[model samples]
Target chain A: MTELSELHEAPAPSHAGLDVGNVDELHEAITAQDKTRIRELLDLDLEHPAELADRLEQLSHSDRKTLAELCPDVFSPALLAELEDDVVEDVLPLLSSRQISRAMEELESDDAVQLFEELSDEAREEVLEELPEQERREIEESLSFDEETAGRLMQREFVAAPEFWTVGQTIDHMREQGERGGDNLPEKFFDVYVIDAHFHPIGYVPLSTLMRSQRGTLLRDLMDTNLTVITPDMDQEDVAYLFEKYDLISAPVVDADGRLTGMITVDDMVEVIQEENTEDMLALAGVSEAGLVDTVADTVKARAPWLFVNLLTAMLASSVISLFQNEISQLVALAVLMPIVASMGGNTGTQALTVAI
Target chain B: MTELSELHEAPAPSHAGLDVGNVDELHEAITAQDKTRIRELLDLDLEHPAELADRLEQLSHSDRKTLAELCPDVFSPALLAELEDDVVEDVLPLLSSRQISRAMEELESDDAVQLFEELSDEAREEVLEELPEQERREIEESLSFDEETAGRLMQREFVAAPEFWTVGQTIDHMREQGERGGDNLPEKFFDVYVIDAHFHPIGYVPLSTLMRSQRGTLLRDLMDTNLTVITPDMDQEDVAYLFEKYDLISAPVVDADGRLTGMITVDDMVEVIQEENTEDMLALAGVSEAGLVDTVADTVKARAPWLFVNLLTAMLASSVISLFQNEISQLVALAVLMPIVASMGGNTGTQALTVAI
Candidate 1:
């Protein structure tokens, strides 16, 4: 097993153990279009998709595309899921519609929808046509909901049991379904929603609760009835807030008639929390989103608009100071005091804004 | 069933559904020290610890003290766990050592250590003496770890099965443990570490996987050997990064000898992520931590030193401008031009700092 090399480990092999992450070596491989070296470099990271995506993100635009074309098989669905949306948009156009469609089909619906969202309009149309009707409809329904809503963020696959089921019956049902699994059940789920005959969730049983309970215990008796039900159209931020407030591992999402439609897990909420926090920080600094792989032009585009606003505001302030030029010519002391007064006000104003934000 | 009302509801009850969270009502009840009214107010919030903690945090300091006195029984271990560190520090002195020791015994060791850390040094000695020996040792062991390390953040209560055990035997072991439960297991856990004879964590299985697998499958066959083991000395921030990178629900914490000592779960990691992000945002503004319950004096205490430094820098700049005052007296245009150049450079410097941060 690889050591988690990025973490602050005790002096072990001088921190040079993660030589596989040396992007300079990969950059040369990409520059020379050396497929063998590229494959060797990638093999080290194939098991760690996020690390592979990070390497791809650090490469130049042309080099990344060259690497992708040299080993198109390296761009697995898991690798695609790990990539930044901005990077995915760059890479998606290079692959065929059949390849993109296959990846979407293989991924969880929530991730599939996100990847599909980044495709060009024409590519989306082509991919949708190629997809199975059921898969295509699932993607369309998720897209129908607004971006950053629970409907879009939730995975269509989940575990639910009826209220009348016993612990033994529930296990049997899940085991039989597991044997037949092909997107029928989520890869991981913490809570099994206890639902009524109408498929409306009444409560949830954590898997731990299920594991510890006797086989004959009824599902209703084991579940905590004070379930925090989430509506599909709820904002992702609010859904995240619910998860944090309740310390929930997963919550069932309901549709208009209060029937269970999907499930939203904590792993997705982690990403949303980070995204929201980054936006909050950037907003305070008067800048918009800027990703690592963003070009110099893109960085300039994001920062320049905010700087221009500050410049206009500064010019307006300076113009007012110019109005005092006559008074300053007679007594230069007035000019020094004036800047001091204005500067004090500006600093205090920003400090207040920072704390309030 | 209380609706998750703070979430955008689809016009259920005109958004007045969470009137139980009304601070004005609680404030009046608190100020009166009306025990009956306090109990009634507390009853509404009993099911939701975080909401109850939120109300306490919003009350005036004096009113809060009065309320705590009126209904000390309301300060449950779960409620204390939900509270901010600042709030807990203020409330610790009011409780008896026995009451505190009982709470610590009931809570998971991670939360117990956190609450124990906030006690007055004298109170810590008193509480430790009152606690049962094993409980005392657990808290003391956690306290020995540096603040915000994996050792401090992880709870000692985790499930581990021997490598030779089958799924059926493991479930039977958990069921037997459950029948004898007081704190033998965590209230919730997502993974089970499969350990070797030497008690080193070799791999793990998610509870979901265990639920779906056949009864007779060996844990060694079911476990994922590519486990991300966290050393107790690892920074909590780095541990949280691992969680996010791998989408881990929980991971085993090991000692220098690689023996599994404790488990850190995703819920704790979520809190750490938020705390780290908040610190990042505050550092950008040159301020320290300020919580909701902090007084005006405390707020000023956190913010003043940075402003003082800014003040010294401004005075230095003004002194330089004074040296040019003689030339400015002859040419008034210099006065206006000086402010413009200085102001422009200052804004650009701050903008660059914001982006860099």
Candidate 2:
């Protein structure tokens, strides 16, 4: 494996850092159907999965498909996770079921669930069947949770310890687990929950605190019991609010009877906050979605329903203008000033609605 | 310190969980100048600072002031941090300089900077003078950075170690620091930066890694060098994008020569994400700010500029209608359908703009 130090030494290919001039070159390559040039350009960005995703997003649908087909290895599991849902959906059919299953296996449960959501039902079944039984079970269990709930957000792999254990025991156990190279442990965790008998989490110890504490310190004594316990049924928005309110690094999710089930990390909450924010902003502007890389047809489809509702509201406003027809005829200025009044009122209403939301 | 378990055991006073019927009762208490009843009502919400902030936001300006005056303790530093800028501004003059300084003292640097931004120049001077010298200096240094930049967003107190230190040595250093309970250390930290002799951050070790590593492991070998380094002048929105892309828990900010300055944590980024979200949402609606707790006059002030701009645009639309006056007189039906067409075009333009933004 390439060490992080080597990765840091390599030039980072971030979306924001990409030159506008390079984009023109990229466009030229795509237009020429120059597979060799496209591969070279993609090679420059292959190390930075996010940048690869961004570059993919910048391409037209046909260009994206051609590039992906030409250099399938560039579309790694991490790269797929970095791509937007729309882009991922666009590319999912290009890959084999084994490839899709492999990507899902490598990702955290929440991210895998997200990719699963974007797949066609047929594709989903194929991919699920290809996955290892344990991975499939975890994904299926996560899918059992309603969309936009804590259950959907929490990762199944978490580190936990009995309350009776000391900090030293927990540390040793984690070291042993790491050495064993098992798939049971979380890929990364910030806190370890201290669970009581019957597997109810009583508290958690931040890794920083655990690191600084004495080996003899009991897990329960060192743990912070004031942490928020997330119920699986809690709405993602409420879960986000709880995280913001408490400045939580990670929170334990509990079953209905309060047994520890999974954990939701702040990283996931950050994504939720942005997603919810985008949804609210787009909804207010009478658009279903922002559709940054959307085709003309997609854009129209996303916006048509909101436009129809707006058409009704506009007609109602016009009808009220008609009610003053007699008044408008006496003073033609009324017709001229009429739109100003209506427009001002509309702007004011939007201002109030924006604030309220 | 109350354990989070005990806090959880206490009935959670949340805005969603608040009795809708009690809003009227709250209004009556304010109107009757019933301080005792108001105190009792607020006490019901005391455990949940965010809920208290929400309840306070729902009240009229005078009522919020009255409630604060009646029960000053309810407006704790945590509660103050949760309130909107406008609401905080309204209550600032109600408190003594001592109170303001104490609140500032209690909050994290990023939060303190927010409160500091809202204060009047005269009040700011008074509050600054009242703060302890070290805190005052820290606030001054932070204030020196431009608003909405990493410098303004970063907290000064962070953990760092010399690059040559071993894991055990670093852990021992943090333990001694935590034992000392000095103001120099960060109240909470996620990772320890490994610094060179020049105080430049070379790499960082997540506490999780530090906890699991052997005592003899060199800090240099344990640290992850593939880290994003933020500059002081970087915009907060860009900072947020980095956090989202990298799923960063914390990032180090460096000075011109790449010396470590401070760190920006994910907790502060959560708030920044929301604030930026609100700003973008309101800006789309043509409002200067989303003054959720604004008085009628404040609301008008916030909306007036947008309304004036709309007035200009509406008049332009009206002038276009006036250009067809002769045709309108001949066919009054033109007058009836004119607004429908105009409104539809307006809505379409907004939809395009929303998507582009």
Candidate 3:
């Protein structure tokens, strides 16, 4: 097993050796060692049991139902993040209440909220009851914020320092806190807010500056006052633009009183940028929302109504065509050339709309 | 002047200090002391200069002839990047030969190619002659590539290392190269291509892994074998899809013989992503492109053509409407609510088209 592992991690080819059958051959080679080849093959495609759960979801109901009977732990939260809502709804009902509770506890707030949003009311109540009191309260509190706002998107874990502290004190605090189980401070952070006695955000000290500054420097003097403070209720689009325009790594989210509540990091903003881009693209396309892990029926439902509207618009345009029908019948050249003109017009219009929207 | 300079640098209330009173005032604001401020404001709201340029170009011949005396460098390459092709044409003649040479030199190869492609035969010849021999050759060569190909969009600056080198040696090489003239390398980079003796890309080591790994790790050992190399002539859309599918940050571009030519960084890919999203959005809207910077006339032109094509298509649908006109005339409710069904259909079609496209 060790030798095979080493072989799998071998040095790269001098040039891209990607071939069409790469995934197939690689899988076959891995499975040649054992009769557990089928399970290994599935594991190869999915690095963990959890991812298998997600992909299995895309399969038909019977397939997932059968697969679940064999491997229940595949209903992991990581897998839930990857599943479409409809498929998730189908799969969640089949899972034991214990399994569902475990998955919710394991997932991030956003992913957990999304999965919870898809559940039937009765199922939600049952699952909520299963969670530890603290976890359930946090999830419920997070849910109270408007969907897609900073309050909802921000992770709860963050580090802050009082304005009067020195850089040395702040570092010592972080060190002590980490040792005492503060190790979960967001995997990445850019700035630490300096709050006043009342927790009002007075300034921000960037991590880079903190790293470079002398240890004894007072935190207040080291902080940047030209901060872009965001309201919890601000639209995600505005947040994304502020981040882009200011080249911000992180910004503090505050309430109406300007007190620091949560910090919005660049990583979260990256998702917002992508989402906003998707929204603009979808909206301009005339759908309020397009596929965000949408199923076939959901996709159909989302799109069909728009096409029907187009059919009506087409009908209206055809009435204009009928207005010129006598003129068209008198001169078929107008009909043929008319299409050319209209085609040109349509192309031009599309170009214009692309620029405008 | 120093006090004013300080005041200008200070961050003011949002939209408070904006003075859009006159063209000269807008010009002064655009060319402010802070380059960042200028860039930010240009991105914000203002009359689209391209629109003004188009209108000015259509003025009496005497007015058009005298417009060359206006501030020349105002038609900077950055501004040119923002302008539409038709608008670019109007402004080109107004620019002095020196300014033209400067703008040409400042522009990326792709942008230069695009601008030069729109110039009149005599103007192109004159401008081409004014450019340095090397730059003129580079632009002309790049212009020769088919539009919307990888060759058209790639930047010439990229970093690659020999496959035999350790990660330490590669980092040292990058530092040394940066110390020399490689400071002109793109502002951001992601992957370091490991090239063979003949300069063909063998594999890639992601920057993230490189940053985390021990310095002495061999490049070949660290490389990811699942390299996605793009050919110069590949369609940009396909390239974008590949990037999205593999979550690529950067990829090496290869020529017909599989020899590495240059690298395409993710920042460039980011622009492509935005452009493609915009294209899809507009295309789904039944328009070819969004005319964001278009004039009322340009907007009308862009939309009229599509509306015209729509007219023909509508007539086709109207013939259907006519077949049922009597049914509609008898049932007034059909006339009233028929539009509702069609409107819904149009919306649905757009939604589906948005997703499908």
Candidate 4:
């Protein structure tokens, strides 16, 4: 399949991936109300089944209503794992509380934590009450991590073998583990952390190196010593930079006690990069935040403060114009040209800021 | 091989494909030269091979110095493509005339035209004289297109097939033609333009579509009728929007006669998106232009005029302060809070302007 087609058909779990086909199809489906075709497409067994499930979930509520209620079972946990927080929130309410609890149970600690974060306080409490005791503890424990830190971002599902294992054994273990029934595992991962007997991550083996190397290579011998251990408390931006600078696909996030907690993957980092880029662009523009996906009232509420501040600045500029009113009256050219100069200056300054920032 | 590794070693032709590895390696290499890496990375790659070729050919005797002789081939075509017009003028003379001619031949016509536009009268004549007649004619013809139009930005090298061709035949044709080798073939293309007997582009098939489709499918059957055609006179900004709005990988660029002349691809659009974004950012910041690779001098040059304009604006704001100077003399608190209000408003205004822009 073409990358574009794959991109469209198989939505990446992360909000970062652009499904051009889904976007187009969704647009068409919404306008035309092609519910039958949508249902057919939804039922089709797909290679990236999780992605397809998410796409179906993301379809308009009106569209989703047309599907049989039993269809929710077809929604994969990975699809739930891939959705945006706001999107998941919207979808969660549509599902039976049992389904919501099950999805939460199926999620890795970080994903469950995020899903919990997006819930209404009452719904969250209800969901927390419904979750199995072990699941609830994991969610609550992850919640203790600072927001927008590695702790919050990393997925708790990870493969780490003891340092004594041979590369062959590690691979075999992972393969054997796969044969056992597990409902949800990351469809892709890039590294295996080598841990001490006590579960302290000592080093890492990039999957690429592991795949190419001899099976008999000891995990300890093969692991990269110059490894980056992300502390749970470290900021997500710093995490992004480390990933970017080191070309890390996935890195282990450790607690203060040096215990491996979870892993942060490149796909997540890609979203962070795009989010950060949007933030920089918006911030440089003077927007308060990026992705103001809340209701229009919230968006306007967030946006208006900046506008009000701008009004004052504009008034300041206006006062400058008012000061030169006499000068402008005497030489209207100054008034006409003054704006040109200011406009050009604003443009130029923005350009400089664009590069510098 | 992983996409990241391929990206690392691919010799990225444009900044559009610049992966983290290149930036990191370049950062390290610059630091290894016993220079502050950040400062060095911030500067233009002026002595880049393609630029050096352009420079040695264009510079007058005595202006060429030891620095000019120490140029490196590692300097990229992309770097030269991004040089400021003024900087291009200053450096092109250091290049060998033959090298200049060869580099021009190697560059996309749009880039060659852009470089040609920056040359001095004497240098332009000398360089043009050295170029192959057909190549020179093509560049000159491209120059005839309005600046910042699709005609100027479009790559002439593209794959087009008659609508009657089956998928197998089209693939065979491309493979055979690639073996034969000629200028008409795009170095890389995202689509195959399907043309009618009259050579008017009827539809397009993304290379991915072409690769995935059944061999017996006719080109006409596979082609997407939802085509976004670019007229030579169309503005580049409008062109950028079409690519973005349609999620187009590539589209046919037509001449005044409505006949296909070239194709514009997403990679090119990606550069345009970045450039336009940079332009918007710089404009908002009151800077003239924020070319990422600008030298300190070039930066200062882009910035100074805006800074001067800002000085005048500041003075205008200062005059407001002066109006309140007497008030300030009476109450120092007025001065302090006055800055607060102005500062707050400035920040607010920037926020609004950023969103608007």
Candidate 5:
């Protein structure tokens, strides 16, 4: 939380963090095993966790391990959260149980769930053991929900107010809560849900609207009743569609009984949109992963399954061509044109399939 | 703008707007050419422009044209903004110059630019001439920028404050401006840029922080200087990457001299992400467009160029195989095995290319 506050206070990182000079210098340092230079370069980027994550991703596997060993603190929770899933998987085993637990604790519930889900059973259990009782329970609860559902995507922290509250009262409450500086409020929120006595979210007021409205305006009057409510079991793609269709910044997640449970923000939706897009693109190409940062072995493994399927399809296509072999020998021209015909047909079929998808 | 306010006040449109029943009824009405029934169905969906857009897309080309002729207002600026580029292109010729110009004027600058860009030269001229002088200049200025750059993507209207202004001054300025209800301010804004004497953006204060902060706090003191400023020439894809990396809601778009020109909001970014993903997916498949709502003819036109390229490649591969024509005739088995080998190679090559991309 302190780091989160500091993140807002610090100037934005220079995009030059990924420039050729820095990468080459870091590569040279890692090559020479110059711990001092590596530490110096990393320390300069300490406040910019995203830049640090990008730098680590560009490093050799052993160099990444060495850097982690040299400065475990650089692999902060924010940095871990920012890393690609494959990169996180690679680095997670290198960290101690204490580091894993601390990172998990620092992340929001949804992010903590993602990190824990990626871990091996034994490591996950060890990290879970290190967490406090309350946080452990929350993570466990989140894990119970099916993957890629609203339940799994939503963060537990959210801001809610009774419908009867006035705009002034809500503002004062937020100010007082900000001063209190506890975990009761979301780290950042775009809107506040207005709930009824039964805790069913009746509507929502965008923070902008709340800010602009007269102080005496009741939350009920100010709230947009046309708010979209999401169910915990709803698929994440459907949730993303809702966000896009409505231009929603944040949405309230409801339980089976229609009571507000947690909230899903647009930042989470942004990630989901990217993930789903990657999934669709990869799946269409018959690969299992995006393979953006995959090692050679990983890429081979991902492609092997699709290639195996392709082999069977190829054999089937060949079998059909075999049936026409006798006719092909009678006419040499047939041999030349046969591939043209087959090629045309295959290309046309692929074209149809692509458009259909 | 009135529609925008109504959009906010009205309860979130029923996801049922595109339900099977309504679509069926609308389809039946269109097929039967029941103008009254079509109007009834569209009237029921008047408040839900997105749903209306979806329904219109699902219709046959003639039916969509008929529906447009029956009730042109149903094809509102928001609906035009929501339609697919291809669909919009198909429908644009059917609308009057007045309808086209009015729609452009009603939409935000980014959306207006998008709609205008899809028009044919003669129609674009007609629409531009029909528009008010000031709005025409704005759209023309937007068009002057290269497509897919920050300048093309940013809205002309945004909120910015002098660095020396206190939070109270900023709040009062916004309130007074809101009351004035002119086109000078963005319809919605999440943050206020704090600019220096030179009108260069120095930092920003999120609306939430502005609301929570004391009124007397100076803008310079309250602003979070850690801001990611986007240059007007920056590619939209690069802008999207920055937004994703930083989880940014909005970023300032600056000119060559570094003065803030306009702003790109998350809602626009969300649309850009979806468009980029669609582009990538289609490009990988070798198709020119997603062909989501395309007719058979349109689909063929879209796929023909890629299929032609495939034809050339296929012919080249066939020519390579023809080099061994003597060997193949001597051993009949070579004919059967040739296809298997070619198929396997093609599949493997495709797999590699997919991963590389």
Candidate 6:
């Protein structure tokens, strides 16, 4: 196991988690303009991008700008993928169009699309111009879909095998493909879809099943046909529900004619589930913190609408109580009863509403 | 594509989801004692066990009791694993000790442990006596851990290989082991642990990576050492956070000696995330509906405590309002302001609490 002290040279390819303690130390290093210490603390090859992204998110605004300026390597492509969208929006202006496009090329398709989406319109045009034609088309085609739909979420890169291929043939193809490290093969995948002439997935086979089966077994015979097929336009939440309900490792995303166009994997579905849950929680609380990213003004704007609605209702409630002002003046006990009853009723309503959501 | 009508003979191996309409039809079929129809509605071959479990969950208690009596096979082992804990508690009593032991034998180790935990002490003794010695021991060992720790959540069955083995050798071993249909090979897995002599995972090879590697490539060279190792004693929520943060498909669970014991998969983490999120939501609402399974009484017992607490606090507020009774008597406007102030303040507090949570 790699110790925390040796993080900059750690063997882990990526660290998706970070400790807050690391951030405090990084802050001091940035403030002192210790470029050597910054590089030692954040090696491009060894450290997890998430560790850096988290550190940057917690930094003071000027510290972040200074760090990015002092150590441009700090905003590695992987770090761009892991950074929160708000932070990404803030950081993109610091990079050149070539730098941004190079980052897009280095990342997987879904991440590349996300990074592309963060650019300002003028920057998007410049970055898109700098990207390879193939890379540029993938980003543009993915962006054509409605946001939060399966089309937007699916990676154009996936593994698909014809039904005629045997396990041995499929393995040979994958080995050849993996060597090339092309856009067609996903960075990591669990299942191989068995497609028909029209590119529809007739069935799918988990890699584990393919591995343990006889090499001579046809992909068709080895395949499990009970796939929960997802259409491109399906809502991401619905996509997530299918993944959860089926214990799916990955599902094929298809076109109108039912041809497999792309695939959505479980790792992405994990995020959608959390997002939907947070949305549910926020909805129940009557707030909409969904897009409130950077400014304190944004936070206030997000939180204020619900309070304003609450105030309007509160005023309505006050009017109802005022109708009984005569009775309250005659008996002080009536006034005491009003607050108790109102408060208890409000709490009970909140409890019921929470469960309903 | 498998249309909605092809459900009974559907090629899909499992459905972890259910349609409410299907549950309603199952209810009608049960009332008529139409065993053929019931079986057609829930063919163990093509249907998802969750579909049946959901049906049982929604049935009236009397309908459920009668359905179990009329169709004993409705409680399939897969359905036993898929069932919500409350529904399992209700259905377990209807099964013979022999039947329960059989279900435990059929299910994966983690699910077998969950089913065992749902049994009454008397029933557990009977079921344990009926189980095979190894199965009985596995359940007992799993039960020794805290309810929501990694030990309780992980499946004891996993695939691990020595680092010295080549890809071909590892593949051959897996094929031979998978052919045996034993407890040690998980039904599905994505990664093969490359472990030391003592069974500590030093690295892991994603099955896809194995598929793409040349047959003669050594497992040691092909493996990724960026493992996010989990301990048996870790809280399941913490385990889930690591999965979401690190985008892990499966993580090896280790014991005190840092030797791999079991593995937790993403499917289980999905449930943990939802469970934690729900718990968080309910806690925010000042309620605990955690164990309120079957009865209306159970619901009241769960929700009343929070409301009672609200009543006590509201009474304190009422006393404070009474202290201002003389002021309110002079100005009716002061009384009107109280409800408006109390309501808006409560809403703001609720919003802040929601965010803090």
lDDT of 3 by residue, B39-91 (tens): 44343223343334433333333333343443344455756655656657766
lDDT of 6 by residue, A91-129 (tens): 998888888999999888888988888899999999999
* Model 3 root mean square deviation, Cα atoms: 9.5
TM-score of chain A of each: 0.92, 0.88, 0.76, 0.80, 0.89, 0.91
- Give the DockQ (2 decimals) of all models: 0.48, 0.40, 0.10, 0.07, 0.34, 0.50
Identify the superior model by TM-score, candidate 2 or candidate 3. 2
The C-alpha lDDT values of all candidates are: 0.83, 0.80, 0.61, 0.62, 0.79, 0.82
Best by TM-score: 1
Q: Which RMSD values do the candidates have, in order?
A: 3.2, 4.6, 9.5, 12.1, 5.1, 3.6
Ranking by lDDT: 1, 6, 2, 5, 4, 3
The lDDT of model 6 is 0.82
Q: DockQ winner among the candidates?
A: 6
Highest-lDDT candidate? 1
Reference interface contacts recovered per candidate: 0.46, 0.50, 0.11, 0.10, 0.36, 0.55
Which wins on TM-score, candidate 3 or candidate 4? 3
Q: List the candidate 6 regions with Cα displacement exceeding 4 Å.
A: A1-21, A290-295, B1-21, B290-293
Q: Write the per-residue lDDT of candidate 1 for residues B60-126, one digit (tens) a residue.
A: 6778678667787788899899988988998888788888999999999999999999999999999
Clashes of each: 0, 3, 48, 35, 3, 3
Task: Give the range where candidate 2 chain B is weakest over 10 consecutive residues by summed lDDT.
Answer: B1-10
Question: Which regions of candidate 3 deviate over 4 angstroms?
Answer: A1-37, A40-58, A68-145, A150-232, A239-357, B1-24, B27-90, B96-137, B181-184, B288-293, B309-356
Model 1, residue A135: C-alpha shift (Å): 1.3
* Ranking 2 against 6 by DockQ, winner: 6
What's the C-alpha lDDT at position B286 in model 1? 82
Question: Model 6, B1-357: lDDT tens per residue?
Answer: 433222122122234344567888888998899988988887777666666666677777778788778887778888888888888888889888888899889888998998999999999999999988988888888999998988999998889999999999999998887678635578889999888887778889999889877889999999887777887777888888778867899988877767788999999999888889999999999888655245788888889998988898999988988888898787777888788888888888888887776
lDDT of 4 by residue, B145-173 (tens): 88887888887877888999997787667
Native-vs-model 5 lDDT?
A: 0.79
Name the TM-score of candidate 5.
Answer: 0.89
Instruction: Give me the overall lDDT of model 2.
Output: 0.80
Q: RMSD (Cα, Å) of candidate 1?
A: 3.2
